[model samples]
Target: MSERSERIIKHSNTFLLPDLGEGLTEAEIVRWLVKVGDVVAVDTPIAEVETAKSIVELPSPYAGVIEELHGEPGTTVPVGSPLLTVADPAGAAYRAEERAGSGNVLVGYGTVESTGSGRRRKPRVSGVSGVSENVSVARVPLVISPLVRRLARDGGVDLHELTGSGPDGLIVRRDVEHAIAFRAQPASEVRPSEVRPSAIQPSAVPATAGQPAVAGVEARTGLHELRRTPMSGFRKAVVATLTRSRAEIPEATTWVDVDATALVELRASLRTATDPGPGLLALMARFVVAGLLKYPELNGYVDTGREELVQYDGVNLGLAAQTGRGLVAPAIGNAHTLTTRGLDAEIRRLTASARDGRLTQQELTFGTFTLNNYGSFGVDGSAAIINHPQVAILGVGRIIDRPWVVDGEIAVRKLTQLSLVFDHRVCDGGTAAAFLRFVADAFENPATAFADL
Candidate 1:
């Protein structure tokens, strides 16, 4: 498209697939959502990628016209492997110009100053012989375990002040714990009218007058040297998404103790049916879908960028499946249209695909609602974060026999726990509570879920 012969018309750039979760080193490309020649915007989903945890849509970091597809569907690529390229350099430059003053850069870098017009390469490191050497030498070593070292680095905890308790008085987890506790203490205690330190200073340390000295000086060790492994594509995405979700979303959660005895009985009845009986989770899924239909308000998304709530006409229910690598949520499409049997079959199929790593990109992304069965893991109940964009996530706890008052008399019945976490920004506590109650009611009387069918 360019006139200058020296300046090639196509400026190729490689789009490396990033890791989506913690410790994920590689991911299989379930499918590509965009083809060559198609223009995509930054944050637009480019492909569905299966990580150890879930099937996640990989969004493009650059806004440009696609030039080529480097790999075929089902091909597994390590994190940082080039996935595709864009043909429009001018368009890319113009978009960068438009976002010049914005805090975000083209890649992971922060805002670029107005002075720069063209793409600039990251400065290279040359054997640490320049001014960097002096700075490196001035850096102090911190004592900590491999795990604690990584945690401290990620948590931004300064380890210099931590005292060691391991061999040769090396800093172990207890030392890090002490440092965290010390840091959490207030500088001064507060009295009725005045704030002052209680007899001891907040940062006071115990006297070592009776302590014995160790033989050798402690040296800090890096966690990377302890274990070396590549990041999986799925894990990379999970890390990015969880970090982004935690940082960008103003999430607030509330918990309610749900009486799930009726639900447990309903599931049991369904399971014991002569004809192909549905699993407990499948029945739960049906109940959730029915509840979403009943409370259409809960079946919507919050567009934080636009300050709007987008309600969907169809139900795309995502079911969380725990795989060997991590958790993966492969969604059941058009959930409202599926009958209980159809829904059960789809759940079984998707669950199998998720475990076998055979799900497509379309199956992973575009979820309307999510169900996390913490019951399988023996958890009673947990408040889970609403999967971003989607307004809510339902957590199902283990089913057990518990005593309950049925029509005034105490009796033992099958019981379970339910925890629904929703975005307070898009939905109020009352609405969320109402939706959970509706789901519980539907589970207790499953015929209500199949009234139309």
Candidate 2:
């Protein structure tokens, strides 16, 4: 549990959404597990809500008969807003100081005081096989995360067929995603195989005023025809952070092209059948860490309230990864202490977790600087946006073979472009340029650059 907020547990019949710490402000209700008049025990999962970082099952802090639910599915509820009302006939569980359990099960929030243990009911079984109308014969699969269940349910993927990749045969989000990708088919193609001939008959759908005329695709002019998806809490959080960064930080950009033939050859020589050695990005990250240590001015953020620039002795390297939800930059804490191999392992782990939408709040916060490998998207360059609070972000473009002048002779060399965007208030162009030059030089001559380390 995080120690950011110190508010007491709700002693009244109404239970507000608890503070999901790490500066998270709100969550979107994915679905409610309990309805009005349902009896619930303390710590019983009442709803599945999605915060900016991940989906969470919100446990009930009060155990009683549920009287009313405050919000519906798909509604956004701010932190500290009322979630539901419970009617305590005995009036014992609603006391602020004598609440059962520590209420410390949730990812971020904690209780003011707790006694007695909480009760939890067993999860109800649901059908996961697509081939069956009845699931009484199917075995219960081990699934823990509500997000994973939601993904599997939405994509029509059969969870029984998948082998869990997580601990103790726990089916994770990525397992379902892999199944969905492998089993995905067009509706027309899938219907013939999965549905009976009698069930395949097309039913007449009413032609609504703003609905599309064609079955496959249509362009309707009416305003009602426009598809509008509500902005999610994740997207909202991103918008708020980027908006704040743009409004508060004075930013500048600097870039340089480097001939990275030596670095490329160096990585290739280090690779063998048993071990692939450190990844190219890991080598670059090593260079970035070294560069930051050499120029500490570009490694920290400016404190607006204190009118001071807080520079840290260590680095938390943020790697920008594109996930199904959105762009997330999960940081590697104390990256300055890690070797290229260590960075490689952490990068791979974080990248996989980021894509699967399983990163924790701690992993997603407190990034000091960011490294974006937009090169994987097949782009040459980007004057990237500065991640809020952090002063700079470095983007590496696609590494490709290009003509270069080597000892006054034209030669083909592996070349790439590096773009650095930093806060202008934190450092002048000369400082930013020098930092960029240091990284570029490292890329050009890995042996010399690494020797200094």
Report, for all candidates in order, the number of backbone clashes: 25, 0
lDDT of 2 by residue, 346-429 (tens): 999998888777787888887899999999999999988888889999999999999999999999999899999999998899
lDDT string for model 1 (270-305, tens) is: 664467577777878887887888777777877777
Assess every candidate by TM-score: 0.53, 0.64
Query: Cα deviation of 67 in candidate 2 (Å)?
Result: 8.6
TM-score, structure 1 vs. true: 0.53
